[model samples]
Target: MTQLTTDAARAVPTLSDEQWRGLLEVRATDPGAVARAYAARRRPDPLLSRKESLFLVAADHPARGALTASGDAMAMADRRSLLARMIAALENPEVDGILGSPDVVEELLLLGALEGKVVIGSMNRGGLDGATWTMDDRFTGYDADSISESGLEGGKMLLRIDDRDPSTAGTIEACAQAVTDLAERGLMAMVEPLPYHREDDGRLTLLKDSRSLARAITIASALGTTSSHTWLKMPACDDPDTVYASTTLPCVVLGGVPGPDPAADLHSWGRALVQPTVRGLVIGRALLYPPDGDVRSAVAAAAAVMRAAHPGAPAA
Candidate 1:
């Protein structure tokens, strides 16, 4: 047996041969943790064991004023209701993890639901949605040490670059420093990069040009002291082929706002998720505050899409 399979076999000694095969099948779909999986198989580390083909529902809406579900505005404004719904979702067997602002995360922490869970802290909320400073992202979430102390799994940040805007420069520099800081502490930093361009009329648009997207990827991938723990949170570019070739870093496609047909959005996501470097997804409004009212159903549907893309992949 290969080192990975051997390690996996030893880790779950209680499993029969059939169960071990099933576990190996699950690990095949997760490109992001393949190495870790291999190591786990050889000498299963408690920290590295993961489920398969899962996604983290983003509940960072309150920070961005996107507090609605299925077009119902401010649906997430009620802290108790939101927390109840989130806890309910987390309790679901299908749902794997959570992505939210520091405040929301702390709430989860207080509820004691974060233990053994994949808790990803949102690192930017200063660029509130539709605000004038939306593009100038800020690090408002848990820092490296804070994440470690909290017993959280990882951290995430937004890096929207509108070259014409001076604030983007600050965000870039701060992001680089954040990456270095997170890496030094042996934590994962998921960096979402967007090459945004503000028109003379102040309308913000993504620069879909291959060169610009590639450049943005290069800059993002090269940030921090060590790129080993860095993962790129990217949008599915107009030319996915070019975007796929832009960087060697592992990536996850981000889910934008909900569209008229949520299933179609997931279908598109399924395609993006299949890319070799695209490890998984960091879906938000599309899954949590879906146009549909059922959070459980919506989350299941999203998980189904992820599974379809890479059946039996290790869960996030």
Candidate 2:
């Protein structure tokens, strides 16, 4: 296996070679260490502060075969590199938490990096990117029971609605059940819903129109028996106010694939954060691997946006 290491002088404490070897030894022998770590993990005070805004770094895309960054197709293919970047991003105190798959979350937990952080488990990744069955986004990751057992703050699932794809129904049903299960445990159920259309070339195209996005919001909001504990992870669309107004459920804007201009992207997110219903940000690659390759700077800039949106919120 590849060994992981990071500069000790760096702000983030990357997994040293010794730590990596130790983790491997534990997994090789004491496989129960992960659960034990979770059981003994320390937690933060309140999940949400008075202002209710948050900033969760996302590191779950790689499990879905979506790893492109800065036009590099294989930028995230290296596990060590990905984890190192995540650690660096989390080093910024402004970063409230992370949204990651079970594997990533466990690794962070084992490293004690998740201490006092809001950890949200990713619940689905069966719909691999560029695959023929991409519309069938099954719940192949963290389930509600496991998330609850691990004491995570919430569970996240991807919901893609394709009018022409029958698999969409199965995903919807699964997500609804997950929502109910999580809610019953008094945990948050974050659903990311997108309207999709498959082209003749078998490529899935997301509908970015405000109406289509709003329709997706309505569908996701109505899932499960109740919406009291549900949160929407929505895109920062052109008309975020109009799209977000479709549902009363609190929302966190998703930082979609990064563009060439970081300022413009943050500007869009800032605009979306202005919406009363849009609580904060759940972003990934954009902030983790910015054009300038400074995770702290990127995260701080993003936190500034959140602060501006919730002027009365306590500082991070």
Candidate 3:
């Protein structure tokens, strides 16, 4: 399967004020258009590029009240700007798909930006960003039936495990069930598992040690009745080789909080992409709200890394 070429990859695209207003108007009066738009949208074929991997743009942060990016507390608060940035990334042919909540995905569908692009519906966004019950992540987004009915390629869920937080057990159980549900439908179930520990100041911190990550990977890998259609979304780490060795399930590197250097981010993802279990990238703020505020350039940079990284053999 040849990748989408430059000639096929479109130039920089636009989302004018008029089109923005039209979306608002439809939202105000005709809500059913959302469903119709999704049903009518054309789906992608041979979803992955020739590399047998994906480069998905993620926009599921806002749905969970995580509006901060690149030092701006309200960076992703503006829907119009967010949608425009997503379009900028999608126009580049190297971008294979997107992992977003229902609202963002529907907006892209209505805007006609998602045609022929893989779409992964975001699930389990009920845990508000900073709430005390953050560990009680609930499935407030697309379910398996809805994802399949919506013609999406798959559904994604976040799993945060904390020893002190008993709520983690519930979240784990829910994700396991979701994994089973998606597999039953013969659809992809993307599970992002991360270990967490609360600080004395009560800050929920992600545990980034290789051991912690490896443990999380094993747990997520074993979820559901079947692992046949499961994919793990892993955070960039210093020891991907050691961490990824914990599971045979296919994995995609996710861009966590953006750092000051985008090159560093790319280096990490590029390294992981070469790993047999690591398939591709599902990046969000790092590309959408890049330090330089150039979405296309950021996307192109990641795409360049994908081409240079030499992905491992096709995933089993």
Candidate 4:
């Protein structure tokens, strides 16, 4: 049997070298052997490691009725295939972390993956697109305790405030409580805020003005118990300068739907990636399951943008 080294033991603090070695020694054991050994001896740490900064690909759209890829509708409708492709992409060396709905989290957990990986649970799915309840985002993912129990690092939620829509107030209050809960549990909460309005035709749309975006961010940043664990996931406004003024909290760009030219999309993403306060991207259908059906290539392209923006930067 291969013996575990001291450094290896330190790297995986949940298990001592001798215990890890013992587990490895039982090679002919049943399929549940490793799991039983892990359960018996390991206590996984449910904290985010500071070694790396991550480009968290968001594949949580299905829960929100966003199943399109580029121009193709129903792109993410297939759950099993999507999970397989996501696992493959995550296996890539350059890939770092994930941001997805609770269903996605359950899928990853059942696959016996996510160990030593940054797992961010999607906390909102009630605000389905085109629904009357779109403005009232609700927490539907892992709570602080569930996140800790599942060994997940953190969770994320969306906040789209449409002043014309009274539901926005409910979302605001819910978000405040959620943030307080996450902070008290020492879990990170990534919040994406949008100041939007429903047009006469009832199509929800974001205001193009920077002032609205800034105000929205400020309103979101002020929510929750502590601002320390909150990250603002904002969209890059028409004027890049406005992005810098939006919020003081650590921010990340939310990848919009992919365009006709993926290369151009990558370039635009690269530009957003270069923003000073922009930590990284929380990309969804754009990167995970592209219209092209090449998850590896799409993820690589996005990873390239991240690498170009912050060369040799560590994953978060």
Every model's TM-score: 0.78, 0.93, 0.93, 0.81
Off by over 4 Å in 1: 1-54, 207-212, 312-316
Indicate whether candidate 1 or candidate 2 has the larger lDDT. Answer: 2
**Tens-digit lDDT track for model 1 on 1-316?**
1122453323321323554354445446543343332222221123222643335667886886666655667667866656656765676655556888876765555454555557777777788777887877777766777766655667888888887899998998888888888888777788888898899988899775778777888989988878988988877655667776877888878887677798788777877787777767777767655543455677778777777777765554
Flag the better candidate by TM-score, 1 or 4: 4
Who is ahead in lDDT, 3 or 4? Answer: 3
Question: In model 4, how large is the Cα lDDT of residue 211?
Answer: 84
- Poorest 10 consecutive residues by lDDT, candidate 4: 7-16
| Residue-pair clashes, model 2 | 0
Task: Write one digit per residue (lDDT tens) for candidate 2, span 229-274.
Answer: 9999998889876898898889999998998899998999999999
Query: Per-residue lDDT tens digits of candidate 4, residues 33-141?
Result: 5444323332224332242345676778888887876565765786656676677667666655688776676555545555555678888788887787777787776
Candidate 1 vs 3: which has more lDDT: 3
Clashes of each: 7, 0, 0, 8
Q: What residue pairs are clashing in model 1?
A: 7-41, 7-42, 8-41, 26-312, 51-315, 52-315, 70-291
- Candidate 2 lDDT at 296 equals 78
Of candidates 4 and 3, the better by TM-score? 3
